[model samples]
Target: MNRTPEPMSRRPELPFHWTLVLLLALSVVLAACGASGAPSNAPAAEADQERPIKIALMAPLTGGAAAVGEPQLNFVRLAVEQFNAEHGTNIELVEGDTELDPAKATTLAQRLLADEAIYAVIGPAGSQEVAAVAPLLAAADLALVSPSATKPDLTEQGLPNVFRVVPRDDVQSATVAQFLLQRLAATRVWLIDDQSSYGVGLVDAIEAQLRAAGVAVVRESVGQDETDFSALVTRMRADQPDAVFLGTQVASQGALLARQMQEQRVQALLLGGDGLMTEDFIANAGGATEGAYVSFFAPDVTNLPSAQPVIEAYTSRHGAVGPFGPPAYTAAMVVLEAILRASAEGPLTRAAVRDAIAQTNQAESLLGIPIAFDTKGDIQNASFFLYQVQGGAFVPAR
Candidate 1:
């Protein structure tokens, strides 16, 4: 599946994690399957065919970030369902709720490590969660494919088993900074971090880029759980900056900030990273999100013809799609495809799946972009896009 990078114009048309319901159902099915174990003398191929191959989706399924994690979980389930139906192989999808907490993610990592049946993981959506679990999973040699975690250090640590479908923060922040300086003509920008690993890293990158361009930058930090932004809004109003960039993983917090800005009569334009590109942000912003901009690593799959089937299936069950779901689908596809490739050759082991993932080369993904991994396990030639919320929907910013 070797492919050269393609330009955007040439591309093809491109979660309630339903966590508790899925867990109970999968538990029963798994119990039944385990009860009917194959005989000791069964052939290797027979045993493999009968055995269930499991992959875990680790996301913030029950916390403030659940808005983003729910879609991620659901989309991974969609991918697993489609793969199982097409291949007639039993692949069990499991869920691990990290609740957007690093400590919780660490515990979940240990649980997954103990479950020898799970060969790979789809997420631990937040960057901090990924950081917390990456070492443990790496030590165990369990493959991890994160759809939303974009911290550059996640891949730079030489963890062979960690992979992601999105561009790194450096790439995303530079792209956003370019849009601010060129497209938005922003001269004075106020940068805010939600104090999470994702927010702090992204804000730092954007701040450096803006400062390098001779743009005036005002930097601030807020707690991840903080909801009140009155003081920040007052400061922004006084500074009268051209735009405010929020680097927060919690979508609702972004919404709250936006509403508070509007209430305080701050005229500065609002911009955010991929984490704020969710339905929760739009719906909860009380119409303040209109015209707000978000820089995302993946394109809107609703516009990609190649992604029509998956999008239709997802929307039929769930509602409209968001930025994170499509990437999660892509991540799931990468891991599942690699698992099949490994299983076809011989017994499927974590090492074999990890090696197979390294060889991934999809000519066109759901977003209609070519997918391939470099030596570091990051997607090759990964890029980002800009979307603006208009009339309550995220559309290409133009």
Candidate 2:
């Protein structure tokens, strides 16, 4: 029991997470066991035995971002299953839904921390949620691997525990801005974003990139629930910029902005980051999403040979995989590897696993890319790809 974290385990025979009184009774029972009753090498056997560890996946399973968060959740579960099937490690996954709100994420994170069994977390789906829970997680020594949160400042905060599989907002924003500036020849651009942390962060990066590239940038901020964008659309129509950049999610207000732009006859090309790359965006915006460009963390994953099996498994069990699915799988894989590596060295404590995760350097993963972390916890060698909504689906822009 000393092999596990102090907060969780104290009894040898029983797993972690039990009341003190119950643990005392179990201790007495173990103490009474004679040489014939309990094996002399039980302690050695226990060390070799695979101990159970719990990892939580924090995402919005109930609110607006559910369309995207649900797929991420599924992929995390699939990763757990695949890991369990292939290895002797006993890893359990817990769900901590934030409902797409940072406040909710904070509450859920507190609950997850209270459960001493959970040493690491996968996501809270959005950068706002991650921001809300980051300080709390660092205080408790819980490491996190975000699959989709792309806000640049979160990793910039110097919290060594905050790691993410996706590229930062700056990388994504610059990639999209350059694509528009050089390829589409966009000169004047209008920028709109929800007031969420993820949205505002991407907008700030994109705005800076556009101005640096000599493209005129106009900026606006809106509430996440403000669906009716007629006034905004009219304003955009008046400007008649070469393109409109929406830094928001598919389920929040980006889809609505796309629809209103089309309804108001705003002819500018619609562009966005990974948040708008979901199929729900096209479905909700209808024909308005056609020809809209999206800057995503990676190219269409379903096309990759390394992704075919994951795609098939995801499709067969939980319908089609989204842009965030493969990254979620990678996030889980990274955490599991950290746990295995830490356990190999010594007892599996939160500190040990956090250290292991910080030193991660996977040569290959299902994402078909090298995975490593810099001093800032940003995934190194990150690549962002541009995609276009063509024929109601996301395809490579070029």
Expressed as tens digits, the lDDT of each residue in 250-349 for candidate 2 is: 4536677888888888899988877776668888877878888888886577888977887898899888666768888999999999988998999778
Mark the regions of model 1 whose C-alpha exceeds 4 Å error after superposition: 1-50, 101-104, 185-200, 216-269, 275-289
lDDT tens digits, residue span 235-340, model 1 = 8889999999999989888899999999989999999998887788899998998999988888888978878999999999999888789999999999999999
CA-lDDT, candidates in order: 0.87, 0.82
Candidate 1 lDDT for residue 215: 97
lDDT of 1: 0.87
lDDT of 2 at 321: 64
Candidates in order: C-alpha RMSD to true structure: 11.2, 8.1
